[model samples]
Target: MLALVSAPTNLGLRPPQPGSVPGASKAPEALREAGLFELLRVGGAREAGAIVPGRYVDDDATRPPGRVRNESALVAHALRLAGRVGTILDAGDAPVVVGGDCSVLVGIGVALARRGGTGLIHLDGHTDFRHPGNSGACASVAGEDLAVAVGLHWPAIADIGGLGPYFAPGRTAHLGHRDDDERATEARDLLGAVVSAREARQTASATTAARIHAVAGTGYWLQLDVDILDPDVMPAVDSPDPGGLDTGELGALLRELAPRAIGASITVFDPDLDPDGRCARALVDLLAAPLTTLGSALR
Candidate 1:
């Protein structure tokens, strides 16, 4: 079974300044408007209902650059999201989580960690290992998804459920990252292994997926960030980087990973930029095709 978990959030972003429009918090509704949920339902996946956060609060983008923004609200909502995920898992459905930002990983990571032995397959354009408090970059937890997941960032987030780290270093795999940001500059004592975009392209996506599965065992949580797509094709992201995969490339990659996923989350697609909805259509197709494959494989 499959369930769509909605985390309509921008908390993981730097929070909104006074006049700023929203960022990825608009993703779930946008994709739904594009008929993603209805299409998935046609494949027999159920709309398990959106996991709404209790409240949302964001810091101004002007906060001291290196300060992690909205720490309190972020932690609180993550706990709430974790419960939602736990409930879905208890019902025995693999949750297809949609995100507010990468920060939603806090809840996903925590739930997986508590359940024990679950590994992570992180696919993104950037490494996302920066902990600004330690690395001196601007503080955005979305920028620190990997670090936070492994108990290297905020104590409230990383240490959720009294678990120290969500995924042990060796059990996690980071893939498709271009490594163009502060991630290149930070020291990665907490991250264990990674399969870079260049390395993945050097081989087949199947090879990379096999390596990820080898590390993760029978099940893993898959985190797919759309920014990992080439900017020419997927420009509706908060941070657009080049030298990444296209929608077809990502679909091919998912052909190997989707069937193995215990749960999955799609993040960082900003519909605000795609006024004509072209990107939204592409995202729905990308999501539906692999998910259809996943549903069949599980059956």
Candidate 2:
């Protein structure tokens, strides 16, 4: 069974303007309005309800070194979201978390870390690998989640609940990052596997699956940042770069991976940029099948 969890948070993103909030926070609602919930319900999924995050605070001016924007709030939300996801997992239900942004990975990491050994399959257009080791400007968890998940970050965010290195670098596979990403080559050296958007687009799903199988432990988590889709198809994200998967390619990859994933999270869609709801509808269409069919192999 699959449980749909709503995680509406934008704390990890830098504000579009100093005083303005990012629209990614409105993603879950927009997706629901686009009939995502109803489609999943009809496909035999149940709603696990929402994990409302603390209000976003623009604290960059006062934040200390190593602290990201809304750092405390982001951690709080992750702990709470972890609790929710843990409950769903405890009941033996796969969770499909629809969220505000990539920062949600911290909470998912917390939950999975408690369960002991687990792997991760990260799909995104950017590496999200910035950390203290690579950049002086490491203020956004959204951009640093992969680094945090693998424990290449400060202890505060990475070691929540004393559970650090949520997923070991050897157990994490990265897919869909553009070939030209600044950190792609460096990330390739540390991660379990690196399949760029260019490669994923050209390779067979079965071949990609085989590569992922090498690093995916007995079980794994699927993290999807919808910006993995081409900017032409999914420009509603905060950063939509070209050289990403098209709708069909993304869905194919998801269908192959979801059946083996214990749980999954979809993030980084900004409703603010999607004025006519076309992106939401497209996202709903893209996610409907895979979300409903997660963990089917186990059954």
Candidate 3:
């Protein structure tokens, strides 16, 4: 059985005009329709105010307080969700988490790390490894999530899920990265390999899957941030970059890798930025293909 965990509370940061965002309101529904939630029960932390703290951009009064109550709540919610998902995984259940933001990765990573050494296949446009003291082009909490997961930025995100140093540098692989900012330097320093978007575009999905399989070895988690897709395909992101993996290519990669990996999870942020919900539906469909395969194999 595969458990579908929902962490829909956007506690870390709230994007601009969250409520008005088309897919933002219907993420849970989309997941349900995709049958991603069929096997497992749903759980999450309490919803805070609608307007939360803006990690990357300035705050907007129009949003609800649910955006920003406290960082501790976000961490607590993640820890709880991770604990539940970990318990399921231990009991032979595959866990696929739907997200509030990329920060949910911290909880999922912690859970996978506690069980054993887990490789990380991070798909995103940015490396997200900014340290506390380091100042660069993009400096924000969200930008440093990857760094925090690997114990690069201590104290700020250390308490999340009660797991430190989520995964080894050598066991991590970054795919579909096109944008480079200040955090890029830190990522290069910490990550084993950062695969460029160009390389991913040129290479076949099967080839890319093979590379990830080789690098990640056994027992890995798949963390995807939708911004890795081109703005034309996924414009609802907090920061959408140009030139990203197409839906078909990404689906093929996921399907090829799902059975090979030990466990996997995905997170979608700023869905509210997508008014039409087209991006959300596409992501759901792409992810569902592999998830269904994984669930069937597990059964």
Each candidate's root-mean-square deviation in Å? 2.5, 0.9, 6.0
Tens-digit lDDT string for candidate 1 (1-299)? 88888888777775445656457888999999998888988987887777665454555644554346677777778887888888888888888888768888988887877787488888888988876456756467888888887777757667876886888877777877885555633423444457666777778877777777787665778899888898898999888888888777788889888887888999999888899999999999888978765633554
Per-residue lDDT value at 95 in model 2: 91
The stretch of ten residues in a row with the least summed lDDT in candidate 1 is: 184-193
Question: Residues 100-156, candidate 2, lDDT per residue (tens digit)?
Answer: 999999999999999885899999999999999999999989999999999998888
169-267 in candidate 3: lDDT tens per residue?
A: 877888877755545655776677777777888888888878777877756777777777777777776777777777776777778777755556565
What's the lDDT for all of these models?
0.78, 0.91, 0.62
Backbone clashes in model 1, listed as residue pairs: 9-100
Q: Decide which is better by lDDT, 1 or 2.
A: 2
TM-scores of the models, in the order given: 0.91, 0.98, 0.79
